[model samples]
Target chain A: MSVTAPLGFRAAGVAAGIKSGGARDLALVVNDGPARAAAGVFTANRVKAAPVLWSQQVLAGGRLRAVVLNSGGANACTGPEGFQDTHATAEKAAGLLDDSAGEIAVCSTGLIGERLPMDVLLSGVETAAGQLSRDGGLAAADAIRTTDTVSKISFKRGSGYMVGGMAKGAGMLAPALATMLCVITTDAELSSEQLDAVLRAATSRTFDRLDTDGCMSTNDTVLLLASGAAGVVPDLAEFEQRVTEVCADLARQLLVDAEGASKAIAIEVVGAASEDDAVKVGRSVARSNLLKCAIHGEDPNWGRVLAAVGTTDAVFEPDRLNVAINGIWICRGGAVGDDRSKVDMRPRDVTITVDLSAGPHTATVHTTDLTADYVHENSAYSS
Target chain B: MSVTAPLGFRAAGVAAGIKSGGARDLALVVNDGPARAAAGVFTANRVKAAPVLWSQQVLAGGRLRAVVLNSGGANACTGPEGFQDTHATAEKAAGLLDDSAGEIAVCSTGLIGERLPMDVLLSGVETAAGQLSRDGGLAAADAIRTTDTVSKISFKRGSGYMVGGMAKGAGMLAPALATMLCVITTDAELSSEQLDAVLRAATSRTFDRLDTDGCMSTNDTVLLLASGAAGVVPDLAEFEQRVTEVCADLARQLLVDAEGASKAIAIEVVGAASEDDAVKVGRSVARSNLLKCAIHGEDPNWGRVLAAVGTTDAVFEPDRLNVAINGIWICRGGAVGDDRSKVDMRPRDVTITVDLSAGPHTATVHTTDLTADYVHENSAYSS
Candidate 1:
């Protein structure tokens, strides 16, 4: 179960004939609730997909009764006709669900600069809406995958309430958000304003810190919906914590399944002048292609780490920097320290700790090692 | 002839026994000039190499009698001992030439973080100093090779004067200069201030635009020395142009020899509100691994181009953007335009033109396509 793990949520998935080989390409989730509230975050890239634009408008109204997602086409860079198609999709979904078009959110992923087969998609949407059930969460999650090897789902039980989420992304993962679409649902009684604040806080710490390839996408969207069917007015602090836990779980899942990744590396930056400085330093280190390759090769090349750190403007003296890999202090005070050969990098998970020795702030950024498989996967993606 | 193509210059290369293969790894270039005017630029990385630190101080005096460069070790991140090695090398070269250490510069390229063999290097400097001659430019160029397969040399004859240069870099090429060591010689009668201004202008338009792999190095240095032996006060504008031509030729050579690269891409951003915006847009597109991979696969994936353009703060409306690969405009008004199939990518050289449709300003950035070979080269680099 994914979204439907939360009470008052029903979901379904259907083959839309939009994707080749007749794979499941469409999904729907409905809020069968006494109250409906929603919040959303979209890609920071100026060029946004058609569904992202449509969903953003619906979410701005602070109420959503249903969400319809398709994975055959991103509908980005398709001009005015793409936006019209997205509008038509929402209108069709609302007509079948007996709700206003403004209450239905739409999301799309897959190839950009292409038009979706609207007839097949609309029919698939109708079939999915009719099949919506409490146990259809897993099916819905499975439908929204492009190059993803597996569907991502997570759930956390709260104090007399529950929160759950599903996400789909394989590549183009970077700051602000990955090239991903995530829908989180909860049965706790909370206002749309409260949901927005909690979602922003959770994503900023989790999703925003993931920089797999340093490539920002045009179709990244994360949504949160609340249904009051649980009839429990949960404590705000506990609610936020549960939501954050679910998001973190899903984010880690994304990391583990990053495209062609051989290692999952965490760059933890500490002793910074400020939180912003820490994040800057961590992101700089995370984006280094050479350092990522060294990690892939199991070479404890701490010099590349320091080279990456030196490229940032964060407050720190070069000679005061320290770096550790796998708990082995390979570089101390900006020079070779502990024997690098003693650091074991045979494991898939690697942690690099950087001490700026400037202040007390810290941040951790997650990334994947650069590999030949990544070049192979992305080179043939569009073709 | 490389740097020695200009009058009043002598150079030599010798085996330093520091490299494993006993290859010629030490080079000495002496400006046997009546005038010793010099100008230099170094890497922008804050954690600079010891050689860069030493050379900057020597160049600050506006005079350089000789430059000693060694391969096999970068002398970077080696703590105080690394600085000491660079100082000792300069002192030995200056002593051999009966000059002050402040007038001698040093350059090192290869693996970072390992201390160089000081005794072997000092002796090799003595051999190089004794062998210096007018015809030793080619040997000097060959000695600076790390991963470089061939030596890079360029020369342009001005009215009664000449500008010639040699550069060594195969990977880690990026903005604010590359992981390269370059020595340019000119016989034109120019002051140190004139040399500094002209060198900066020429490099900003040439070497600074080459960004292969987008990784800055800790030891990037470009030195220009004027021997003023031609006894000709060439026109300043013509001299700058000649120098820029030589720099541009060497930059292209670096691009062609970029490690594991199969295609050389020139991303030209036109119709920008400002030149900086144009360069920002061009660089963003050039750095996109997705786009680079697509180019390598010979696919006209214009959508990746738009995605990269959207990531920049450059002045452009999403719908008005246009991109053309080779001469075919595959994207216009941010949508699919002419037939992508018509774009031929069979050649090693590729040109991608992006039209921001904002203003008349424009810029061009040079880069290499991402490939599995790149991953292989960098992964095993420091091992």
Candidate 2:
């Protein structure tokens, strides 16, 4: 159930003084392979972190041997100096692993705008490299946590190859990929093109659908590395399925652990004018603070849902919209329909379905309800 | 300091059992008039409240004798019955006065999806007409409030005329007019076209820039009535200036009294490519929940500001952006610039200045920080 669950992968986590709280803040994952194929999906935010910039350039060759990640400083908005720090971190990792510096990828998380503690980070990377093992995925996942209460790890067993992944995120989660750092490993004989296609598809359906807070981060990065150690060239479709399953599992974990969230909601928008419209209406409902607040209080206030739907450009009449929560038609034809008291929201999982009554396209977005704990956790103190 | 400050306005407030809480939930304002030229702006929300729909139809003839507003029910998405309720309220107000129902406007605010109690609403309108007096503006303002801690009232004195207004709103505020109801009265003679132009301009600069919680309401309405009671012909420019001043004053009061807000933040975006771009950038920063949370915690977390700016299409170099908090330049050229600890945030008034360095256009938006109180007030068992 971890990244190292896949064959031909070695991983480790190490503590560095970089985190003043005295926790593990550095991780190393190496592909000890006969095949080195890699693909990556970085943050959509224009103001990206130094590591994101470095990794995007490094992946231009479609080859990667190792990855080094840290969770102390995001190394974002730190100017040219921040870029130099990221470059140095990659060079240090390459030196310890007998690999080319250009073939190494780097990821960073934690507070933005501060320079990383270079000395402590390099020492931790050296220690992590020495401790790397086939069963070190759990430790590597632990090292990447920021405010998350638990590390995320997922694995999907297949006919021949296996898919494994790890992720860490608790805030600034929204579109185009959540505020997250994830690394996936697979022991399948797939080309770089195959890896890229599956990675993008898997992430678009998983990471890009988590909108816990409607915030886009500057340091989101997801990487997929393939090493053909299973000695079987699996069907591309089968491999994509397994990769998507692993990502789906990781996304659910991230949503469940979203900071201060009490209810994990799945919003489905059907009968829209287009796929984009469906997603737009769904996101509008998912991000409504009033609706989220009502859900947190367990109030089946479907009026807020209709109000949110009205804010979008989706094709639907004010009198034709319909809404259901937990299979109860609380609103139909944009007015009161069924008994709202019959709907139950006592559980952590909630489903809200909106019928746009326009076309047949549909989309789903996973979100969490707003709670006082959300404000308390986010506004308590500075990192 | 209220609607009565103007020369020709008579107002009243009466108890309406429509609100189960037994608050003063009904109000009436009459133009004791010689001149009846009027103009109004209603909510941009596609799913508008019944009162918004009724008021738009009533103001189409460029005349209005009185306005009747009620709290306790938004009468939004409540189907055709809600429209009938609004029509009945207008008819009841006109029956008590020597005026036509077509010359009466109506507005309602409170929880959405519920139908207004027609019996209570009509009775309150009749009683309000009987109690109308020049000193009743304060009571009328008090009657419109739902969760507002204080009634919002403002008066702008001119050389020969005065503009006075009253507003009620504590939540569901955003641009294109906030979740607010405002009635402005003046004694100057003006055409309906002139009134429409000036009211639009005033609202565009004032009420449209207050985005407390980024949720647009279904019942936002602003009305302007001129009675020519001062027996003086005021200059159009002078009257417009007074109208803008009154709206600005009311906007400030609304921000200060925003539900559960801990601080009032003024966000100014300068050096944008256009006025629209400046406003767009400023609003993006104002609506960022992460930045609001940091402000509530009193931390100068400028990185969050940069993250929000990146989400927009505003023209600016990623490394050339700058930000200031209070009087300290905390971020310069997209990097750390000031001693963050030197900037104090103990005051309730906080100013965030962003320098886009793209062009010469600028705009400002007023907002509030997210607090645990905001979440508690919004999610506490639903109003």
Candidate 3:
């Protein structure tokens, strides 16, 4: 399964001179189908980019034929001019595809508070439309990238249809959806409500669990367009399951590409009185810079983890808490357990477990360790 | 006005080999009192150090004579033995000062989850006690530090009394407090209730408003001891004013010495519907790593600021919000206001102003920028 596995969809990617390194920075994907059902999730951040706002309004009716994306300028904080640019770009794509402007979605990534070059953007849209092909899915995935070291794409095969998606983000990532910009294509015949329900459920557990630095972005967007090109629609449960797999795969890929990330960490909080408590405890540890740095150094600093949990509103006796790092029980009943010297944390994957000893409720949050390279990359970028 | 400027107090500092660099790592200050009223504020973190638990219990009675602090080995997560080490250290200090062990407060900083070398600690306590002097305030201030670039000490002379304090912390500093340890001494006769009232009031506005990375610490403790040796007790009004000033000064110094700090930022939120709203908005900006990094680069990224505040529960119209960076109004009513280029942010001191246009409530939170040096220093240190 690949991004092009979805039927009745054609994609094209191009270089548009938006990025300094001449990387692919323009993409176009069109639904050449009998179905136009669409759903989208955008950044909760109030300071949204022009494209995010524009695409959100476009998706409100649950109908979309195509999407145009570019990487370089975020088109955020550019005032009315930025919104006008997004509208104009959408109109240009609409003209080439002979579709209503409102039926087209737009997304942008890269430095924030910068305006997109209208000339380059308009020309790039034309080029992308001209180069659109059924086998262009890989190119589309590559175009919508910025600081990401590689493109993120996921796919899942269903009994009658398929789900495919491409995402781009490295830092400024958090549960509120981070700075990610993603596009998903499907060949399942689904309504607006059904698509939204499945998308929300999948996102809640996938994208929402990827927290690198706990920083929300102003240009985050994820759009799903389903074209009834496969001529078959499975039951809601089956479609939802496949959707979840695709989202989870993309989310995992995003974590793997997290900026300056040395390891992918899974922080699990178990035996909590409630799921909320478990999630709260897990997020607290996921957001602790000290703990993340410790993990980066492979020090297995369970004390920092305990301290993080203590700061949460979760009910737990300090002495009753137990902690494990990388399968080694380093602390038990709120006291030091086994010798930390015996724990090995050199692997790229790390797991931290906290037993609250309250009940059976549990939750797990995915995160990445903090490293100097993360700081260097972020500080060097204008965004 | 130094730590020793307060009446009825003598302080001393010495090298104890606790710090790998052999810097001053042991400090002692005694209340040669006619009045020994005291109050304390400790870390809210659940994974507390053995010394924090001991100090908290001893301070419950509001009577303290001396405080002993070391700059290396936090003595946290060391299990029962850590508790024993804390008790032994306090006992040694009590023996030398001819006071009950419970009356002596102990604090340890540096790497977490590490055990103290009891032999070296005992010898250091003895050396600190013998080196105690009336004018050893500066040395004492220098000794109780870890990862701090400079010593933090502030003093104020009252009509007939004096107030002084010393503090140490770098990162893991936030509103609920960080890895901080502070000691305040005064020569004003006051009851335990009075001391608690004044200290709480001062802390709520001063130390609580200093948030670096939003990571609360496990060993944050602030001790205030009063001795009536000066035979001058002012009214509650004057005492509160003096205490507030001392706390404010110490808080400022802490911000100045923040780890990997390249700039000190003051985020002021005004015209909120309530003080809580103001604090929430201010803290949102203070805790945003992206905003901090943007500020570090001197990029007036007001969009990130707005995005951060948007995530808060504070009620406000997006277009009704106004923001200013470094005295230049960059955003008005949630849109571009002026030329961002005019807002020069190259200086180390940066101020962000947000107008909620809801009411008269306001709050100011102090924070530091996120930088590569911060990540480097924190990740390089092995727990």
Candidate 4:
């Protein structure tokens, strides 16, 4: 179960014939709630998708009753016509549900600069709204995949409440939500302001830390809707914890299921002057093609680590840095240390630890290795 | 006649046992000059190589008589002993020419975190000094090869003066010199300050714009040696133009000879508010892994271009952006324009032009496609 895992919520997925193969490509999630509170975070890209623009405006009202998402057209760079299409889709869903169009959010993901086939999409929306059920979470999850190899769904059970989210993204990932589509459903009795704070804090620590390919998207979005069916008004800390856990789980899933990834690498930077510096340094190392290539080759090449670190303005002395790959200290005090040949790299999970020896702060970024398969997948066609 | 194409310069390339199989790994270039005014730019990497450190100090005096380069080992991250080795190498070269060690600049390229063989290097310097000749430029160029398939040498004859240079770099390329070693010889009558200004200006427009990859090197160095043998005091603008043309030619060669690259991409960002924004936007697009993959697959993915631009803070309305692959405007006003099929990619050279439509500024960056061979080479061995 995804969104429907929470009380007072219903979900459904249906085929819209938007994808070339007639795959399931449209989804709907509804909050049949006594209390409607919603918050969202959209891509910071100056060029946002039409649906992202619509959803942002809807979420601004601090209340949402439904979310409609399509997988075969991003509706981005389609100009004002695209915006009208998004508005029409939301209004149609609202009319079918006997609700306000201002309370319906929308998201679209697929090829950019293409207008959605509104005829099929509107008809699919009517069908999906009819198919909405409490157990439709998995189906809804399947409807949002683009280049994703698998559907990403995660849920966390809090005391008398729960948080559930489903995410879809393959590549073009980085900080600031990592080019993903996500919808969160919660049955916790909380105000929209509380939900907004919790979502921002949770996302910053979770989805924003995975710098997959350093490419930000124009349609990245995450929506959280609360139904208050469980009647659990938990404290802010507990609520934030549950939300963060679910988001982190989905973030990990995104990394593990990254398109064409051969190995999942965790780059942890320690002993930084501040958390931001640590993240900056970690991101710098994680984004280096040379370092990622070395990781894919399973070569304990620590020199590239130093080279990447040197590019950052973070506080660190060149001679005071240390790097360890898979628990073997291959570089210490900025020079070669342990025997690289002894370091085993046959596993798919790789850990690179960099100690700046500057301060006590630390941060970690999750990433994947650059491989020939990745090149093949991204280069095989335009996606 | 590359580095020695200019008057009052002698160069040599000699076999050094530092590299396996006795390949020529050491080189020497001497300024048999009336004036030894020289200027250089080293890598901005905080983790400086031993040779880079030595050369920086030598250039601090605003004069240089000779430069000794080794290709098989980069004495970086080797600690105090590495610095001592660089000192010894420069001291030996100075002794061979009866000049002060402060007048000898040094450069090294190859595996980092390894010490150079002092005995072999010292002997190789002696042999290279004895082999120095005015016609040894080609041999000198050949000695600097690491992963490069060809020797890059360019010369420009000016009014009563001439400038010649050689360059070598395979990858770990980005702004701030883009990780390369270059020795420029000029017979123009100019002071060290003039050389500094001209070199910075020329490199800013040439080598700095060749961001092959986002990895900056710890051993990048570009040295300009003026022998002033032609006794020609040309105008400043004329001298700068010649130097820029030579550097630009050599930069293009570097891109053409980039390791494992099947295509060279020239990214031009126009209508930016400032030159900095133009370069920044161009670099962001050039470094996108997804975009690079699309290019390697012969996909003219202008959507990826907009996504990359959205990541930067460059001033532009999303709806006003346009992109062209080759001469085909596939995207106009951030919407689909011409058929993407109209663009052709069956060539070694590709150009991606982005019009931000914010102001009247522009910049161009040279890069290469991300290939499977690139991943294989960077990952297969610990370089």
Candidate 5:
């Protein structure tokens, strides 16, 4: 089921003339009742978008009644006018929902540094509000997209309620907590603190491990809002699990939709001296364009992988290191292992296992193959 | 003047069949007499090439007579056999030069992990030694290239002597001291410690500021060998300046030949709180694929530039930050400064200036536009 498939929540999506292609440019997801608690994670980039700054402050006190999202203009680096535009949009959304402006969150994605066309945006907001329905989740999901080829939404049925989310991103994606604009809605009763904890834990493993291009965005944000319509709060343990599952599902979708991506690569580092070391090594490999490109070319260039891992400070003897690509041992004891000719890397799913032989700790990072389309798409755009 | 133009040095380049295309694959550069001091820098990557490890140990005492290099195989992560191959190659070179094995430095680049066709490599060494000449510098430069489209060589006449060098790299390049293999021959006398200082200072601003694809290689190395054959070593200050100039020229050439690069972009961060901050900001911009691609498309997308700078920790009020692309102020105070139509970004050479307005420190980094050709080349290669 989709995010708005729950009770006491209504969502709508509308074309706002913001996108040049005339796709849905405005989307609204609202909670129609009793619970009004929210938590959010924003981009670590010190230069935040105007909408990100506005929503961050609004979510500070844990109250959120609606999220007003628009696709087309990022509303970033637009200075004072951008900030004012964000405020005005929030005010309009809150007015339509019969709530205070302070209770609405704002999100924008698309080209950066452009001002929002307020005339179209305002009219689109009115249309969205008029069309709001509990079953409109799928439409809303399809609305908040920029470069993403497909809409990403995930749902998890918990002990008493359900957690659902929609995310949009294809590039400028990396992670500290989350790497894209994601809005999650739930019918379970949850306080701000519990939501914060569960969101952080869930993101730590899910979104935080996906590095498509290693570019972190100024508009990256993840918002979790609880409707409390079910009137049944889940135990903290179960709530965390459900949240984590939903996040994982969403993260997987983001990876699958990474720009110019043909394969979703999983680099697993095992036998590291510590979990941190494994993560460090995995990240190094995940960010290596050479290795990624080689993988895209279907070349079992295990040496590039070794080179990436070696660049990290993680302690391990090169001789003790072992590498396997696509379930075939390519290198062992710092030397060539089995016949590399036997390894096939043309599959859409690729895995690289690096055994450090240092400790029991392990970590896995998801990445995408480098492709010509990535360069073409990114280079052709002005933003 | 080229590297071998210096007195007391003999060099040669020969085809060893290491390259499948039947190109030159072996080079031998030797110091004939009167000097034995050398200094070296190797890739910071932990998964080092076999030659890098061997040279790191041999250059520790600061004395060397020759450097034996080969293309077509990096000899990295090949385990014990790789190390053995490197040793044998070095020993053979030393034997031909009438020098100790420990006195000869070794470097190899090409495909990584594959064993060197020892039979071909050893025979090529003999051919190279027999063909050694003082005018073989250019041939040596050409012999060491893998995917590089052009030969990189530079020379400078110091107060009383001369310094010349060559380098080869087209991808898997970034600045962490050095990103590719280079060798310099100097007629001036200098100790190992002195050479180290001079090399470090030169590289700090030259090779250290180059970011091509943001990928660090496993076989990067830079070696400087002084012959002291002229017996007219000048003051260290004058010598260092000349060395820096030569390195800068070579570094620029490397950028020009960067894979799939259609334009060379220079990003300068001025008025930063500290030099480190300025460097950090410059690097952040240099490593951005979106910005690089935008520049490639001849689109002045200043928003990507601001977004990149925002990801860094440099202290700057986002609104106060001003960006000038190709000498036109596209953004000021985090907003559009002037008409974007006035800014032209169609030049092959472009400069982006970011005024942090926080301090007096500044830094500049060299990068290239990301193009479809680069993606096509890298994605098709296995190594």
Candidate 6:
């Protein structure tokens, strides 16, 4: 159970020939509530998909009655025709669900610069509307997968309330957001303003920090809907923390399922003058292809880490920087500190800690090692 | 004949025990000049190697009698000892050549964060000094090989002068400079100020724009020495152009010999608001691993190019963008244009022209396709 784990929400998944081999490729989530509060975040890339452009407009009203999502076409770079298709999809879902067209949001994912199968997609929307159930959360999660190997779902329980979410992404993960589509639902009593504030706070520290490949997508989106069916107002501070935890769980799942990844690596930068500096340092280190390849080979090459950090403009003296790999201080004072052979890198999880020795701010960015499988997977993706 | 092709110059290459298997790893070039005028450029990375720091100080005096270069180790991040080793090497070369220590420059390339075998390097310097000859430019080029497949050498004739150069770099190439060591010698009668201006102008458009892997090195150095042996004061503009052509030739050689590269890609951005904007957009596209991988697979994936352009802060409207692969305009007005199948990619050379349609400025960045061989080479390195 994910979105449906919360009360007053119905979701369904169905195949409509949009994806070949009759695999499920359509999902619909509807909030049947006394309150239809919603919030969303879209890709930072200026060249956004048509669905994202439509959803951004619909979400500006701070409400959403239903969300219609499809896989197999990104509906991007198709010009005005693509925008019309997204509008048509939202209108079709609204007509079937007895909701206003302006209250419906749409999302699309798959290959870029392609058009969706309109006839199959609209029919799938109707079928999903008729088959909606409280236990259809898992099916909806599975339908949005492209290269993801498993369904990502998480639920966190607050006092007399519930927060649940589902996400699907594999590659092209970067800052602002990964190439993903996520739907989150809650039964806690909250206003549109409160939901928007909480969602932004949660996603900023979770999904925004997961950069697997450093490639931003044109179709990343995350939406949160509140039904308020439980009729209980939660403490704002405690409720925000629960929402953050759920988002963090989904982000971690995305990292674990990243395309062709053999190891989940975290670059933690500490003693920065500011949070931005810490993030800058972490992201710079996370994007080092040489360091990623070295990690793939289980070599504690701290030199590559310093080289990457030196490229950034963050405040740190070269000779004062320190680095540790897997709890072993391999580089201290920008020189060799310990025996690199003593560090064990056989585990799937690896952590590289960088101490800037500047201040107290810290940040962590997650990424994957560079491998031949990654090169193979990406090289053959568009073929 | 490369560096020694110019009059009043001698060079030599020698095998040193610093390199395993007795490969040539040490080189020396001396300018027996009536006028010792020189200019140099170093890596932009703040965490520079010991040799870079030492040479930066020597080059500040605007005169250099000789250069001592080695390829077995990068002598970087070794604390005070690393700096001392570089100073000692330069002093030994100066003593052997009957020159001042302040007039001797040092350069090194290879693995970073390692100490050199000073004992072997010092002896090799002595041997190279004794064997310096006018025809040793090719051997000097051969000695600076780390992962380079072949030596890079170029020479151009002026009215009554000669300019020749040699370079060695295969990977860790990025903006500011590549992981390279280059030495240029000229017989033109020019002052140090003129040499500095001409060298900067030439490099800014050549070696500085070749970003093979988007990974800058900590030990990049390029130097030009003028001996005034020809005693001809040529026109400055024409001389600068010739120097630029020689630097461009050496830069192309570096691109052709990039580590594990299967395709040499040129990303030329046109119709930008300014030159800096054009370069920013081109470099952003050059660093896209998805685009690189797609090119490696010979899949004309223009959507990846658009996605990369969207990530830059350059001035461009999404709907007005266009892209061409090789000579086929596969994407026009930010959407599909000509049939992608019409494009041929079997050739080793590929050109991607991106029209921002924002203004009239233009820039080009050279790069290479990301391949399995690249991943394999870097992954197993230092293991």
Residue-level error in angstroms, candidate 6, position A56: 0.9
Chain A TM-scores of each predicted structure, in the order given, are 0.98, 0.96, 0.96, 0.97, 0.96, 0.98
**Number of colliding residue pairs in each model:** 0, 0, 2, 0, 5, 0
Pull out the clashing pairs in model 4.
none
Whole-model lDDT, model 3? 0.84
DockQ order, best first, reads 4, 1, 5, 6, 2, 3
Fraction of native Cα contacts reproduced by each candidate: 0.70, 0.68, 0.58, 0.79, 0.79, 0.66
RMSD per model, one decimal: 1.7, 2.3, 3.0, 1.9, 2.4, 1.8
DockQ of 2: 0.56
Where is model 2 more than 4 Å wrong at Cα?
Answer: A171-178, B171-178, B231-233, B381-383
lDDT for model 1 comes to 0.89
Task: Give residue A340's lDDT in candidate 4 (0 to 100).
Answer: 82
lDDT of 4 by residue, A49-154 (tens): 8888899999999999999999987888898999999999999999999999999999998878889999999999999999999999999999998877788999
Sort the predicted structures by lDDT, highest score first. 1, 4, 6, 2, 3, 5
Specify the poorest-scoring 10-residue window by lDDT in model 6 chain B: B170-179
Score candidate 4 by DockQ: 0.65
Cα lDDT tens digits, model 5, B73-99, are 888777778889999998999888887
Poorly placed runs, candidate 1 (over 4 Å): A171-178, B171-178
TM-score per model over all chains: 0.98, 0.96, 0.92, 0.98, 0.96, 0.98
Candidate 5 stretches greater than 4 Å from native: A171-179, B171-179
TM-score of chain A of 1: 0.98
Least lDDT summed over 10 consecutive residues: which range in candidate 1 chain B? Answer: B170-179
Identify the candidate with maximal lDDT. Answer: 1
lDDT (C-alpha, whole model) for all candidates? 0.89, 0.87, 0.84, 0.89, 0.84, 0.88
CAPRI verdict (incorrect, acceptable, medium, high) for model 3: medium
Clashes of 6: 0
Candidate 3 residue-wise lDDT, B1-383, digit = tens:
36788889899899988777789989998999988999999887777888999999998989999999988778877778899999999999999998999899998887776788888878999999998888988999899877777888899888798899988886444221236888999988998889999999999898888888888877888889999878887888988999999999999988887878899999999999999999999998998877777787777878778878888879787778889998999888777788888998889999999998899999999999988777666666754
Question: What fraction of the true interface contacts does model 6 reproduce?
Answer: 0.66
Model 5 lDDT, full chain set = 0.84
DockQ of each: 0.62, 0.56, 0.50, 0.65, 0.61, 0.61
lDDT at A296, model 5: 81
